[model samples]
Target: MARGLVGFREQAENQAKFFVSRGIPIYASVLTTALEMIAAGEGHVPSVLEEAWKDREFSSPYERALLLCASMRFEALRDSSHPLAEKIGDDADGQGRVTREELDRAIDFGRTLDSLVRRFVQTNEVSRSITWQLAATCFEGDGPIVVIDLGTSAGATLVGDRIAQNWQAADGSPIVLGEEKRARKRYGLDRRPVDLADSDQEGWLRACIWPGQRDRVLRFRRAVEEVKKAKAAGELVVSKMGAEDMVAFVRQIANENPGARILVAETAFIDYLPPDIRAPFEKDLGDFISAHPGRAVWSGLEDALAPVTEGGGKRFPAEIRLRRASRMHVVARCEWHPSVVAIDHAELAKARTPH
Candidate 1:
């Protein structure tokens, strides 16, 4: 848990072993347990946890993180001395139970974990293979593009990808991807407004850094500045809306902008939807494609794992999925072409800045 949540640490190996004993996938044991420790420490239990820990079922790392995240909301409410009052407090307005401040912090932590963990996993050849497989499915095209990011927290990945991407041009010529000259139009959407008010975001971002990786922090900071400049100039726009609203908005945008290529990347989203809710969520994706036809793209990680399992290997379903869904793809690529965009050093350098 500590290793997964906190990044490379001495005890990660032991903790990972502990997780293996429980039949919880090592990835999950580290992440979910770490999240639980953090969430419970902050004073809450997620509504989905009990379900998450249920008997044998596939559980995704992101779902575990989300469950931990959603539960963090109850900390203030659960802190009350009286049970009834606490229950009442739990029922208190969302403001009292989960403040915007807390949510922002939690989400930031979750995203940091997402980024760091991905980096950690990528070090392994197998993980790299998996990433290539997924990426191949995403970056397929001869494309000079306009990028649209969904669930783009603080526009980190979108800007980072743009800054870091190394891909071929539509003419099949190798383009370094970020010359900082391409007039790439970028947009982002999410249900909650991200309060990236400098200091807070930077603090949260810095906390996620691994010791020798301070260099990455510097790069992340530069990328963040680029994004900030873009937003300030109105070249980038991030909207507050739920998944459904986002789909509708994107549909409209895609329809109106035929010549502009769209790329939708949902970093650590898509596992929050309950199993029952996945149909509609997927339907929304399909609908967006049907509406925009070949012009739009959508990418995300889907947690195929069940949330919990009993003591011996009996897996059971939870109210939500736990997988980390972080991928990018174009609608047209799904049908005719599929490829992965390699991250160039320049883009990675720019992306390593402090949030």
Candidate 2:
């Protein structure tokens, strides 16, 4: 419990700091107060989080707690007339502190504590730019590209590959991919996939967005809309399955499409797996890639601290890796949400060594 509380505090404070730096003062204030309340064991917050604190299901207690807070705020903001909707704003004086009564009200607003725990972070669009970059570098093959998205909540990331998006590199150059190189085939797997066409699911996706990031909210909504349109036209498919199952399915697809280049991508999903499962998953991935030498690539944009025995013990805030034909490359070390990316050419040159 003590470790959980300490971890939760650190995560919350980090989230608060990020929001503050991003100009969302309202979120920063709410998260800061939430952290304080959790530390003091005040209000119903501690009781609400008690089970999660004890459970080892969460890889990051901070993320679990912070997402709960965001969920509450999302629920509160859904009703335009809600007190919090008017209080949270970009204006300096408009960022009001979250009151105990308001917190209680949010708790009573229908979503159970356990339900919030089960909710996955669906911010896959954040990694779209980086995924494109990886595809360009790792998948320099002739055949059509097939992207299999693991832990694909709402399938926004899968859909993102099909649509046109503007992204800037670290040096502010525009990043682009030709239509031919884009994933002609897209498949997504999730324990529970959110249907973008459903109003309730759409609302939940909206709720998942941070309170004040209008650009992100808009971007997410647009992605959802595009996916819905694509699905209706019979251009995409997202299946309900776990990560391990998704890998098996990818192998089957590879068998069917002999020469098609496969790119298995996961962003922010691998961190949720337990240590026991995570290691096996990586091994399974390596074995699968080894089975089909030059036809496949496994790309990941995950926490830099993920336990990798190789790579010389250097730590980064976040790391992007592309593995193809027994060779692994540490492509970039970037911000958690890599809206801007810095490519390490020197590291890229050295990454060709067999892992």
Candidate 3:
């Protein structure tokens, strides 16, 4: 997987070039960190890289690997002969190191790209939806409510939502809540085990923040911190299962919770499944929601715009047509069943606007 070193570096340099091009004033320390992470095979690279750079004062190769690896699938970097191709092993002395070959092997740009894109879409939805939903409705009742998040990535989206609903602070700033209400239940389901180990993933998350949007970053960071605390306290739970399994789990949760309202958010996740897989998944999901009857919001690349037509006669709507150049679109759907509930279409429209 090590073939793309030159190209990866080119992209990195391109990124660096972009910063230079726009005069963004990236810290040199950060640049060095980015380089090392990109070059090194293994070590406490990701975590150390993250901890050392928390001040936003440094970025490293490690950080770059985290960012670029999580988001891009550039084929040139997919050589498996590199040092990073396999998990690095330790010597008798307990020191960790990886050869350049390993680094070369470990780089798979496409998977990383998918991960990064998924992350971006989900976080954008949370930033836009969670705070308002919590303030307006989620916490309105007296008793606690259960939350089941399908296709949860690292459970970050669910955790972020709970924090927003339960925490005293407003969406951005850390405003303390006088009320003591808290969500009673939380569950997350996904096919792949979310990478709790990747601090650079967290850091890449940090990088996405607009300078003026400090509060949004803080909100997410705080939510993540809570999950860490819960895990430390032995209260965190996440189910390693895919869409089908998750739907089943939700059914059980619904039966157990009994009238407990549900919050289901699949941020940019459902589109990955082909129609055949998606049909059963969607049907199961629709059934579960219909049975439980609560509020849910789904945001992703929409087939509405690019409908897969039969007979090969048509394409998606004019607006939904995939951008020939970027090939990315964001769409979200929010529903509240059982007679009536509120949906802010305008807010969804604003959130779905392409980044």
Top TM-score: which candidate number? 2
TM-score leaderboard ranking: 2, 3, 1
Q: What is the TM-score of each candidate against the true structure?
A: 0.45, 0.78, 0.46
For residues 1-355, could you state the per-residue lDDT of candidate 3 as single tens digits?
2222333454466565444433332322123334676466444434433432333321223334335432322222233432332221111111224343333333332344344223432233233224223332423456555666556666665555445532222122343323223445566677764554467555544444322234555566776676666556544566788776777777676677776655554544666676777999877776654443223322232334433332333222211111111122232221110001122345434433332
- Tens-place lDDT per residue, model 1, 1-355, is 2222333222334444543443434223334445444456543323223323343232334333433322332232234432222212233321113233343344333333333222211100011111112222233355544555556656655455434433332234553333322326677776654435565444344333222232344555666676677788887787777776676676677677776655555544555556665577677776665454344445443332433333344332211111112222221111001122222334323222211
How does candidate 1 score on lDDT?
A: 0.40
The C-alpha local distance difference test score for the whole of candidate 3 amounts to 0.42
Question: What is residue 26's positional error in candidate 3, in angstroms?
Answer: 8.7
> How much is the lDDT of residue 110 in candidate 1?
30
